[model samples]
Target chain A: MTAIQISVFLENKSGRLAEVTHALAKGGINIRALSLAETIDYGVLRLIVDKPKEAKTALAEAGFTVTETEVIAVAMPDRPGGLAGIVDLVTRHGLNIEYLYAFVGQRGENAVVIFRVDNAEEAITALQEGGAHVLSAAELSAI
Target chain B: MHETTPCWNREMEFMEEGHLRPLQSERLRDVVARVYERVPYYKEKLDAAGVSPEDIRGIEDIVRLPFTSKDDLRDTYPFGLFAVPMEQVVRVHASSGTTGRPTVVGYTRRDVQMWAEVMARTFAAGGTHIGDVVQNSYGYGLFTGGLGAHYGAELIGASVVPTSGGQTKRQVQILQDFGSTVLCCTPSYALVIGETGREMGVDFAGLPLRVGFFGAEPWSQSMRQEIEASLHVDALDIYGLSEMIGPGVSFECLEKGGLHINEDHFFPEVINPKTGDPVPDGELGELVFTSLTKEALPVLRYRSRDLTRIVTEPCGCGRSLRRMERVTGRTDEMLIVRGVNVFPSQVEEVLMRIEETTPNYLLVLDRKPRGMDEMEVQVEVSERTFSDEMSKLETLSERIGGEIEETLGLRVSVRLVEPRSLERSTGKAKRVMDRRDLGR
Candidate 1:
C-alpha cells in the first residue's frame, strides 16, 4: 500500500523505449525507476515513475495499455541488514514475494525497496507493525 | 445468362439438380421411415421432439428435421450414421481429428460407387477424357481424398496411376511414363510436384497434365493461379465434405472461377453462424448440407463450418447446379489474436503471391508476459528461389508482415525459414500451430 507499480506494453523494436520516454518526458513526468521483461516480440515496461497517474495517462494516450498495481516500499539502512530486515519480517508473516526490485531514495541514507508480494496490504501492515519505515510516493519518486 | 444443362445427368459426375430433387425426396422419406424403425438414436430424437417420419415429405421439409453435428457422429462412435448393418458395410473412411479422436464413417459398396461417381464427375468436369491417364497424388486410405479422386478417374475410363501421395520421384515418373493428363491432390502437394518436376528437368509444357483438381483444405485463389502457372494446367476447384459425401459434391469445369456444388446430391444452405437462421443469397455464412440421396449414411443439415458465399447464378461452364466461391476459412479455425481475427488462409494468400515462398508455413500463437497474444509465422522459403543474403531475408519478412497485417487486420511477426524447415505431413499439410489457451 505504500507503493504502486505500473506496466506498459511496448513493441521490441528500435527506439520503442525512447518513444515511451519522450512521451512521458514531454508530459513532465520523470522515470524514478524502470525494469523491462521481454519476450521474442514485445516487452512489458514496469515503471516506478515520479507521477504514476500522469505517466500512465500519457502512455495510454500514446496507444499503450497500462495497468496499475499496489506494491510495498520499505525504507531500510543502505547497509547489508537493511534489505534483510524487511525480507525477514515478510518471511515471518508467512507471505511469499512474487517479485522485488529496489531504488535509492532522493535525500536519505535509507534506500527504498519495491516489493510486489502476495498480500501487499497485509505485508505493508505487518512491516509497519514490525518497526519498518515506509516512504510515501512523493518521498520515493524524487529518487 | 444462358442456362447450362443441369450437367448433372449428362455428366455422371453430377446428378442434375432437377433429377436429384425427386430422388432426394424419396430418400428423405425412406431414411426417416427406416431410421424411425431401426436406429434408436434417430427414433428417440424424432419422438422426443414430437416429430414422425411422416412429417418429412421432401427435401424442402428437411429444415424441420433436427440438425446433426459431428458430436452426433462421435456420440454414436463407429457406425451410428450407417443405414446398413455391419455385414453390409464394406469400407470405412474417417475424419482426421489428430488433436482429439477421429470420427469414423462406414461405407458400403454403394457408398463407394457414390464416391466414384462424384469423383468421376470431378475429373470429367476438368475435361478428363477416357484415354487420359491421371497421376492421382491424393493420399489413400482413411483420408478419402486419394481413393475418392482415384475411383472418379477410374469411373471415367481414365487410366489412373495410383500414385497415392509422396515419393516425388515416383510421382514424376508416373506423370511422364503414363502421360498422366490430370493431377488431383491438395494444392500444396501439387506445388511440390511442380517443384520436383523442374528439379528433375521434366518438361512442364510437354507433360500430359491439362487439368488439376485441388481441394481437401482451403486454399487461396492466388495460390491456385501459382499452381496453374507452375504446372501449366487449367486448375479447377473441387468441393466436398467427408461427412456429407467424400470428394465429389461439386467441381469446377473449364471455367476455373468458382466451384459448382453437386446441389442434387448435397443440398446446401448458408445459415447465419450465430443464430442458425437462413441467410439470403450471395451472403457469407456457414455452409450447411443435407445429404439428400446418400444411402449407407444420411446426414441432414450437417454444418460444414466452411465460410463461403453461395452463388446460385449459373456458371458459364454449362452447370446449373449452384456454385460456391473458394472456401476462405473454417469458422472453427478462426483465431482471435490481439483482438484481431486471423485465418491461416489469409497468410497463405500472401505467401503464394511472393513466388519465392513455399506453401508450407506454421502460425505460432503464444501469450506474452503482459497476457496479450503474440503471433509468429514460420514460412518455408522455396529452395529453388532461395536467397543467400540476410538483407533479402529481412526484406521478405518485412514484406510478408506488411501484407499479413493488411490482409488479416492484425500485426504478426514473420520469420522466413529455410526450405523444409517447417513440419510437413505425408497427408495434408499443417499450416497452423495455435497455442493460445487450448487448456480452456
Candidate 2:
C-alpha cells in the first residue's frame, strides 16, 4: 500500500492551524501522517490522509491552497528494516529520499510507509515495476 | 575651576536677544541661497513663485519663501530635504505611517546636540535637575520621544531609568524602589499607570514623582488635571514634530499656559493650513516651523498639521519666545464618521469628563448587513462601574451616547465594555478603527 500525500499552505497566525484542522475534521477526512514546514510568513502543512482527493477538495473549498504529489508507499514488516529494505532498494535505483514517515492501518496486519523523493513519479514507477505491492487509493480507503 | 551649568534653553530662549539672531539671520540667508542653488525641488518651487533666494535677507524675509508641507516631505522620500551630503547626517527619524508613507528627517551631530539641549531646557522647565531620577516611558527607536527625553535627562545630569514603555506593574515597582522623581511619557500612558497602580494597591501618592512631561498627542486640560491628581505630580506639555525636530522644539514651563516655542532652534509661525497666511494671535492655525540651527535637514516654514493657537504673551516662566496652546486637534486626525465630522480628541474629552468610564476607548466603524455604515464607541467602564446593576450600565451608556451625539452632531452606539477591556497602548493609542469596506 502507498501513502497518499497532500500539501496545504497556511498563513502564520494564532489559531490558523486549528481553523484548518477543524475544517478538515468537519469534512470527515482522517489524517494518517502529517509534517509541517514553515517560514516567517507561512507554513506548508503536508499530510498523508486516508482520502487524498476528497481531503484536497475539502481544503480547497475551505479557501486553502492545496497541492498533491505522488509518494512511494512501501509496506513494511512492522519491525526493524521494515522500511530500510525499501530505502536500500531506492538507493540502489539511484533515488534520493527527501522525507518519509510511517502509518499503520486499522487492520494492524501491515505497516504503510510514506516517502517524499526527489523524483516521486520515477520512484513510484520503479517500486511498482520492481513488483512491490503499491496500494491504490481504493485499497487504502477500504483499509 | 568648577563645571559651568549648561543653559540648554538659553540658545532657544534667549539667543535672539544676544548674538544668536545675527548668526541665524546670516545663515538663514545663506541656506536659502544654497537650497536654491543645489536642491531642484526648492529651486523649482521658489522659482515658480518669482522669488529669489537673494531676496531673503533676514528672519523677516522668511515670509517670501513658500511654505513646506508634509506633502513636500513625502514627495522627497528618504533624502529629498537634505541640503548637505548624506554622509554628514548623523541620525534619521520618521513620523509614524498612519496616514501614508512616513516623512523622513535627518540630523547632524550639532543638530543632535541642539535636540538634547532643547530637551534639557524642557526638562529644566518641569523642575528637573541633577540627582533627580527620571523614568522615561516613551517608545524608543526611530521615534523621537524616548531618545529625545533620554538625552535631555542625561544632559541635565539627572539619574535616568531607561525603562521604555510597557510592563505597567514593573514600572510602578521601579517608581517605588528606584525613587524616580520625574516621569516622561504621553499623557495617556501616565493615566494608565495611575489606574494600574491603584489596582495593585500601590500608594501612588507616596511615589517620588514631582513632575511629568506629557505630549506627542493632543490631550485636554481636564485630562492633565486627572493625570496630575492620580499620579501626584504637576503635568507639563511638550510639543514638537519630527519634520521640525523631535520633542525639544517647545515645552510648557510651570506656567502651564502654553508650550514655549524654542525660538533659537525653531522659529514657529501659525499659518492657516488651507491659505498659508499667518493667523492672528489666539486664533487656531497649523504650526509652521523653520529650523534656524538645524544643519543636516533644515526645513523652511514646514507646516505641521497640528492645530493650535500661538500665544506671544509674557509667561511667568520668563521665556519670551512665544507659546502655543495645547494642540486642540490635528487637521489630518479629523474623522468623518457617517457624514458627521468627529475628532478623537472630542471623544477623549467626553470620556475624561465621565467619572464612571475608563480613559481607554476604541471607535469601531463597522457596516450593517444591509451595507449601511454604523459606528460603535466601545468605552471601558471603570472597575467601580463594573459591578453596577444592569439599569445603571444602560443609563451610563445612554449618557455617553447622548454626549457624543451632542458634541459630534452624529448618533453613535456606546457600549460600556468591562474594565480594562480596551487594549492599552505602550506608545500612542490608535483610537479609531475604520472597518467599512476593509475586506474589499
Model 2 per-residue lDDT tens digits across residues A1-143: 34557876555668878977887898898877777765453455778777888898898777665667666677666777667777776777898776677778777878877777777677877777766667776665566
Model 1: per-residue Cα lDDT at residue B51: 83
Cα-based lDDT at residue B365, candidate 2: 91
In model 2 chain B, which range of ten residues has the least summed lDDT? B1-10
Candidate 1, chain A: TM-score against the reference: 0.88
Cα shift from native, residue B435, model 2 (Å): 16
Stretches > 4 Å off in candidate 1: A1-143, B1-8, B11-23, B335-440
Which stretch of 10 consecutive residues in model 1 chain B shows the poorest summed lDDT? Answer: B1-10
- The residue pairs in collision within model 1 are B13-B121, B120-B152, B249-B262
Q: Write the per-residue lDDT of candidate 1 for residues A15-119, one digit (tens) a residue.
A: 878988898988998787777765565555778887888887898787565667677777888887788888998989899886677777666687878887768
Backbone collisions counted per model: 3, 1
List model 2 lDDT by residue over B297-323, tens digit each: 878888787887887677775665778
lDDT of each: 0.77, 0.79
